[model samples]
Target chain A: MSEVDVVRSSSMADEHVIEQAPQSGTGELDALAAALRDGQPSAVEGIYDEYGGLVYTIALRFLDSPERAEELVQEVFLAMWERRASFDPMRGTLKSWLCTMVRSRALDMLRADRRRPRPAYSLDSADGDRPAMEIPDPSRASDPAAVVETRAVLSALDILPDDQRETIELMYLAGLSHSELSGVLGIPLGTVKGRVRLAFAKLRQHLGIHLEVES
Target chain B: MTTCAEWEEEYLESLAAGSGPSLEVLAHMESCPQCHLLLQKDRQIHDALKEGVRVVPPPAALKSRVLSSIQTSPSAPQLHVMTEGSSPARSSRQLHRGSILIARLAAAAVILLASGISAVNLARSSSVTNAAVALQLPGEPVTYGIVQVHPASGIAYLANASLPAPTPIEGHASEYELWYIPSGGVPIPKGALVEGPDGQWHGAVRYPVQGSGLIAITVEPAPGTMKPTSLPIAAARV
Candidate 1:
């Protein structure tokens, strides 16, 4: 199921969605998550098949080596399996949670290697050298909803004001917080917040999802 | 009073910060679908952006590596870290014992447990072993340690180590490696032992050690080696 569909099921249509678990991409993700929580071996295979490319792309772009990236992917999934009980789908989508895990562990790995020079780049993030939107991701070909969601995000990001876009990239891609972005971009924290809010608002509009909070 | 608008503004800031919604915002969100939807869309956008990344298919070996890792590497050997269960500190004389006593008494007990007939023949074999064994430096032993073999995994953990921590010397040999040497035969490399906070070695070997050989430890290079280049500093036959 596409991220857009996940968004709609969990947040768009129902006001009571907050009280229930956030559903993602048919009940398959939910089933996978339940299996994972129960420490089933099949869950690892399912999760890897679904999210391995995403994990590898993020790890590869950060670690800059295919071997280390591969190791990191293995580490991430194994860790997720070991600590499956901690995962709560009510908190967020599995993809985003895995993104967070990949980023965190990759950064930890980089930090632990004191002999190596500190990475001045994001640990796990989207491949930035190419316009990812333009590239048709073969992995997501089976799920058109995912494809459209990817395109919409990239397209919305393209239309954002340069300042706002830069702010979001620093915060999201660089894994910087509001204060860090403010410090890096030489702006006040409020300005950092302003740019993110404006960028996200415009993104929501462009992606055809509007909420009262955005106003 | 914090208005819903104020709570909503904080909620947006927290989401953009990549921090999850605060309890205040969550409480607000429980009553506010608008803010909840905002959170959902924000997450969807992030995931979508990540999905847009160029898919670099991982190496085919990664599947085997991940799967075999679970099969081979058990959870950290927390329960096996110490064997003595309060084995008293040995005096210097005991540390210098001229001979190795295999767990013969325990083996005899094991035999006697099978009724009186089996105990006599098994006492002299020196083949029966127990969970705990002493690893000692040969010939008027200096510092000694204990090796606790977890029967299920054959992974050893050190206890009451009077031996100094394995030092990284000459930038080549950094860790203490465990080896299993059969009687009058070549030493098979087990794996490196990691030093715990208490300065004793802690590690598990993936090898299927049968306890039919002498388990020995030698300081070797970091990440360990296939064979030992130096004589073992401490030896114990299980």
Candidate 2:
């Protein structure tokens, strides 16, 4: 069966924001790559159908405009198809690679657009320019327990000390590297790293994971 | 680079920063099971955060536009070429029509780089009649063809035997779109090309593209798009 056909026949659920499986299984990605190499038109639709929301979410988190986010989504997937030959499954999962690509490209777009840097706010910005903080509906989780667990995790994140929370948002959601965070936040690299460590420890404690937080 | 206890803090900090691990940490983790498990746990948390964010569906117009762009782009078989080679772009500074230089450069042959052609210094002789460069698609022998440009006229002509018929967009025809990608600027669409039976597409631009500009071609859905939906099949700096 064609890759598109197999995707259609599979039991993969479309509604959940928190995917149970890693984004785009290796098998599915392999098939998509092959289809792209063969010039199959269906691959484009198939990929978008599968990961379009995730791509859009990442873009929206970074760019802050649904219109610009939409444009990045289109550009990213098209670039994926164009650069299909460059994808290496052994190196990483397709989803992670896609996220990294989207982040880099969005950052590039942001740099190109170069708006005035808004004054840093202690709370989430009033301009609606904060990186993503809204949580997906917990009910969208696969099971009732999963839903509750998901809510707990988000609540844990929400209640984190403001500094730690901001650090997390800047690093993960804004796709900032350590050096970039230091420069942007006007904090020392060590301080930025310390904040992230404290944030992760708090998150793990809230989620009930027993992982150690090294001092 | 530091003791295990110190490395542990450094490792978690790096992960939180979205930069995975440094080589020193990587080497250390390979030898230490505890560090490996910590790395795994860190990664799991990172993945959850990434996946748990709210989902936003793309606007209705995006999917059809993306589909239309991909359908009309160059066939994928051409990209099967290995991405290792000395970039033809490095030598492109000498590109000229009937220049005989392409042959000598092709023989100088240190290495072959991957896909994406870079065009440099493409010009017509003193006559200023026709300034053209070659478009290189991915292939073992490097599929290439002539691209004619009139910087003053803001017109470009593409003639390549390897060029395929434009892929048709849903509910619309297809056309080849030429774009000039300026350094540090977003790609600006020059105009659309209508393929003749002989497999050539040409168009006039709204503005002049200056020297050493990058050019690219993508087959886009018709009622031609203001932005490109597919990656350029060919990219060259001219």
DockQ of each: 0.12, 0.17
* Docking quality level of the chain pair in candidate 1: incorrect
Q: How many residue pairs clash in each candidate?
A: 0, 8
Q: Scored by Cα lDDT, where does model 1 land?
A: 0.52
TM-score (C-alpha, index-matched) for candidate 1: 0.35
Give the runs in model 1 whose Cα sits over 4 Å from its true position. Answer: A1-24, A114-215, B1-52, B73-238
Candidate 2 stretches greater than 4 Å from native: A1-25, A115-198, A202-215, B1-54, B74-238
Candidate 2, clashing residue pairs?
B83-B114, B85-B112, B85-B113, B86-B111, B86-B112, B86-B113, B119-B236, B119-B237
**DockQ of prediction 1:** 0.12
lDDT by residue (tens digit), candidate 2, A1-215: 10101011011112223332235666887787677656576777777876777677667656665545655776687688878778776655455557767767877877877842221221253355543344445566565444444445555666677667656755654455666666555689778777876776677767654333321
